[model samples]
Target: MLSRVANNLIWMNRYMERGYSVLNLLKVNYSAHQDSPDLFPWTPIINNYCGSDSGFSSENSIECINHMIFNLDNQNSIINLVTRSRENARSVQEHIPRELWLGINSYYLYLTKPELPNKLYQEDPVVFLDRLLNHQLLYYGKIDITQERGSAYYFMDIGKFLERVIQISDLASMKLKEIAKTSDALERSFLWKNFLLSIGAYQLYLKKYKSTFQEDFIIKLIFQEQLFPKSLYYCVNKLSRHINQLIQTNELVNNDLEFLLGKLQSTIQYTTIESINEQGLTNFIASIKNDITNISLSINNVYFSNQS
Candidate 1:
């Protein structure tokens, strides 16, 4: 496969995964705002997801949500992401399945509807977001059912897992930063609940940790629980498997990438809640995020350098 095609495939999946995660964050944050209006501020979310230059430094909830969802100028907005995802897929249409392309194109067209912004602003926000979320689910379903398990599949799968891990880390880190500011047990539990729900892990958290929301255990679940698909350990493990398959089948000679991935996998696998506390949660998360960034750069340098 051409490097450009591979790059497009990876970026296409990354945008799709990122847009879905952001939608979840927006929906959960909206609920959190209603549940604890004083505690849940939109400024931090804006800064974290949208760049600092997004010009929405102030917290106008409706305005922020609208901008994040519809503003093409905001590069990280859902509309922009879906647009980019479709563009990337279009560039490599032959490499992907027909159904997948149509699904992506349909998603892009849905976002283009002028009434969406007004609907989200005027009507029930959850319903509006859920409709888009369901669209994403259908798109992903098409990818899984239609795409063959070939090199293209591996590339896209890697993109999906990589983007997921990055998002999990960012969301967990943001919640942890907020958690650090307050010592109130009740507030901490609320924050943790919001965090879990943001990543669609709340029910599993309740099932596995029947005890009152223990902070350490929640951290453990998100960081290393292999059963949880969105956990850092699980995503990294899947990323390693996909990369390994690519290596074996393609006979790619990229030692730096393999080494970086192996190191990251080992770090996540060996990390414990106790150790995380010892290292300080903020510092520990920073390290993991840094490693993930390095891995991303290594992949670009090795596989996609030929582009441009």
Candidate 2:
């Protein structure tokens, strides 16, 4: 595939994945707020995931949520990601089909309307986020079904899976920290269940563990389960498979990426929840984030950069 096409595919997936990440975060926090009214702090919620809480510290929940959701300055905001995705789509307009570009462009324009912000923040925030997420998923489904499954598809898959892996890791880390500090059993269970729901894994988790809510079981499912798509191990395994395909096809030959992914897969597959707890789950999560960032950089060097 041409380098420009590959870059466009990679960024297209990245921007859409980012949109989903932010939407998931917003949905989770909103649910938590409903459950624990007094404990819900919107600012920390924004900061914990996207690091955009600093600018809107003094604002009320409505204002803060609006700013984070609609403001262009918040780079990770839904509006921003939509805009970025459209920009990426524009760059590769000739490479992608016209229908796909039109769909993406329509969504981008929908988000930027003058009245949309008020409707999203004041009338119903959850619905707004859900609509945004659904639009993104629709675009992805179209891409998967319509686009040719070639090198471009591989790069797009890499971006989606990698972004998901990193986002899930950060969420796992944040939930672990919250669980460790909280002393209330009720709150703990709510938070734990909320974590699962955040990743859309609660039902799967219940089925796997027979509705058991043990910390160890949750950790194991989130980290080790290969069937769960959001699990660290599953994401890494998917990434490794894509990387291998790239290598076999001669589109990419980055042994360093293979090694890094292999290390991550091995660690997640072999490490125990007990060991993670003993070593500190936060620290372990931090390490995983660093490893993922490093692997991403390696990919950029080997595949995306001109020097490669």
Local accuracy by lDDT, each model: 0.86, 0.78
lDDT of 2 by residue, 4-59 (tens): 67777777878788778777777777767766755555655667645754555632
Q: In model 2, which range of ten residues has the least summed lDDT?
A: 52-61
C-alpha lDDT of residue 193 in model 1? 89
TM-score for all models, in order of appearance: 0.96, 0.92
The C-alpha RMSD in Å for every predicted model, in order, reads 1.7, 2.5
lDDT of 1 by residue, 1-308 (tens): 78788889989999999999999999998878877776788877888987677676756667778878898778889999998889999999898999999988988888898777788778888888889999899989998899999989999988899899889989888888888889999999898888999999999998998888887888888888998999999999888898898888873456677888899988888877778889888888899899888877778877685221
What's the CA RMSD of model 1 in angstroms? 1.7
Question: Candidate 1 at residue 212, lDDT?
Answer: 81
Residue 174 Cα positional deviation in candidate 1, in Å, after optimal superposition:
1.0
How much lDDT does candidate 2 score? Answer: 0.78
